[model samples]
Target: MRTYFLLCLSIVLAANALSDNLVQAADPAFTHGVASGDPDRESVLLWTRLVSPDSPELELTWELAKDPTMQTILKTGTATARQEHDYCVKVIAADLEPGTTYYYRFRQGNIVSPTGRTRTLPRTAEHIRIGVANCAKYTGGYYHAYDALADTDDLDVIIHLGDYIYENGATRPGDSYYPSFLATGRQHNPPHTCVTLQDYRTRYAQYHQDPELLKLHARYPMIAIWDDHEIAKIPMQKSPSGEPIYDAAWQQRFNDSLQAWHEWIPCRAKQGEVIYRDFQLGSLVNLLMVDTRVCCKSKVDKTEASLKDPNRHIVGDEQLAWLKNSMLTHQATWNIMGNQLLFASKGSDWSRWPGFPTDRNQVIDFLTEHPRINFLITTGNAHNPHHYVVREKESSNILLHEVLPGSISSGNNTEKSRSNPAKLKKLIRAQESNPDLLWYNNDAHGFIVLDLTTQRALVEWYFVTDIRQKQYQVYRAHKLVIDVR
Candidate 1:
């Protein structure tokens, strides 16, 4: 641990020096670049941050065009980057055409932000491809996955499953939990777990300045939801062994993190405090995003009764009703369930749906009852990729199909089990015991591409060769096709 921290110290010192130089720059600059997200048929949200003279607020004008060039500007507006909001600007350019692409840029006087491209949801569609990715730890590896994702031209939108930025303490060299942690010369911004609003904002800025992440964000609009790391390991998380830490200032930290999330992430949340919402992708898909990480999850207790308790809700009651209603009500070709946690029961992993069997069965029962819903689920959090034929039990009928894409940068199952024979055996045992688990990759660092058409949906697992270095090659490692009948 001593040597691990020494390496961390060096990376932190180097990063801080670079950060100091950027902070001292004079003229106004769009240091983090531009991004767009929360796309709907008529409008989309555009985002950028400006570094300038330390003023209370700065007004910036934005223009949206249908073309890459600014020759024919479609929409123009102005927004303010206030000091309280960490000098970030977000604007919703509304009343645009459906299924249309728009290019936008922000200008604070002479300094113009990079132009970003975004597209609105279509009213009708025969084919669409959506990219799914999660678990990008800045210290764990290079952002090569993001760079590869930015190059995919066929993708329409991206869904981030969580762990966008880890709130954990600074990573140490040879960190076992992550592959190649701190080998890429990147360290957590504050070099500590985030406990304040500024900490969270600074962490986000660290990620935003990454060229690959900036490139991807500037290209496709993202639909993101938080998982454990968003509020995990920080001011309000449990102890390492899952024991509650009352001194964490839980509520305040939670509030601060969520505030920063709303400010930095380009999401069009439907309610003030709710992140559980659905997006209609023309007639092809209805993307129902739910909050399993934070909406209302009872603390984990290992007792049999506690684990099986109907009252110990992980997804809560109201969200269940909303999920069931949305699943039943949608008329699209596919009702895609988006979760930060896998609804599948991975035997010993109680943090996911398996922890609350009652609620897991409840969701399973609803899907079994409504067979016509044509349900499919995309889950994240696990670094490895997983494919499941979701069911209540081995004998139970199929409830829905679930898929977990490989992490964008986090360590894979192979990395964790490499030196530990028992760990590898445990995963093998779990796989042998669970028949519903069709397949999962023990090793991979990549993303998932979901291709949808009226008759079928195809999940392509694209993986990168290495994350230890900046340059790497990406390839489609696996593919699964689901027939929608």
Candidate 2:
């Protein structure tokens, strides 16, 4: 017995010595921290970024648990964060239980991270609540919207409708807030404007480093889509086309940026594309995430004549067809369209379904043809919250409902021209008065929370107090409900 005890003591001492050595060598990176997304009934995508003094390869271990405290382990795995991939780690874990909450964490050499809890989609329509949002610019201010949404109780999913990051050039010197944010206490990493694969990857790394973003991502499963900002501003067809447009180089950059996005985000890629895909939350609802960016004929310049170019395409032909068929064939009680851009005010430079008239009309026609379809559209790109009614050409009858969840951090850019404070105030008042143009919250920065059942779908909009400050305050600003027929 004495010999055995000594042996055990020696082993424990060796282990302690090793742990101490690792702690001494630990790097104070992980600025981007950890996140989880693309949750399913039984699985989820786990993410983390390890920022070295200079990009360097690192190894990490991750684990999932049944308890928020992570006392009970369900499964665990190992992964590498190589410089070849920007040191961002994404692991898809399977075999989890439905409607269950799981806790996850990552471990570097010697330090363990704070735990994050994520819940799987419920198997049945006992009822599910979800939140939707998009367009968060770290420079804007604090993530009041994220703070508010984080405090929100009973959320099953958080749907982000795009503009996840900005890829603009240096915001002209003295642009102050435009270039680097005052609150984030610094500018974006790769500090210069992004146009290449490295630029895009570093930009995502920078944004994901926000504490508010990390908190929001750690909590709920996110259903996401990409608008122009995810790549470059308004990269419609060929407009502002990146260098070597037709050359394989541009395609390679586009694909590289997309692959990096896929590696960093929780969403899946089908056939090497992030375009259109569907998700079912028990029997209560189905969310169709579509790509409104690729495969379209380039936009005619915003010239007067071009505005009427009945040929401009936003949803593209293939995607539009798929969207219609998906809506028509949905088996769930509620059909939700996770579109990136605005649909109500088409024919505008905004480039939503409106930019593509033929496609927009077809969508309108499909809604009319399928009167039984209880449809709801959740979108981002406006950077502010908006609610509108989708109508058929000849009828005032509301054919569909759209909830434009605003940005978590990003604010309105063209507030002076197209969307000013006066028009915004009017729309806010119109919430109760106008049936067609229900509501709008242009000044605030925040996100939307959604609850769905067989009989109705309800959305609650949360507002962020200020993105320019270190402290973020969130408020529940608005709510809307659509009763299914």
Best by lDDT: 1
Error of 2 at 404 (Å): 1.1
lDDT of 2 by residue, 1-485 (tens): 11211111122122223322332244634555456777778888887765454446777889998665567778999888777777777888789888777778777776665566677777886577788878876565566677567557778788888878777654434563553354355555676667688888878866765556766776666777777777766364654332224557667666766766776777766426645778778877888887776545455456656646655566656777777777666567888888876777632344556656667787887878878888788887877778888777787877888888767766563332242457656545545565666777656677887888778888888776666666766777898888877
lDDT of 1: 0.78
User: 1-485, model 1: which lDDT tens digit per residue?
Assistant: 11211111122123223333454568666777677887889988898887767677888899998766667988999888887878888889999988877778878777667777788988887888899889998877887888788777667789998889888777775566444754566777898899899899989988887877877787789999988787765322343334555645777787788888888888876325778888888888899888876656767778887875667667778889988887667678898877987777766766778777777778877766667778889999888888988764546766678999889877777777777878988887888789888888887888989999999999899899988886799998889988886
For model 1, the superposed segments whose C-alpha errors exceed 4 Å read 1-24, 177-182, 234-248, 270-272, 392-397
- What lDDT would candidate 2 get against the real structure? 0.68
Clashes of 1: 0
Question: What is the Cα root-mean-square deviation between model 2 and the actual structure?
Answer: 8.2
Q: Each prediction's TM-score against the native?
A: 0.90, 0.83
Compared to the true structure, candidate 1 yields what TM-score? 0.90
* Most TM-score-accurate candidate: 1
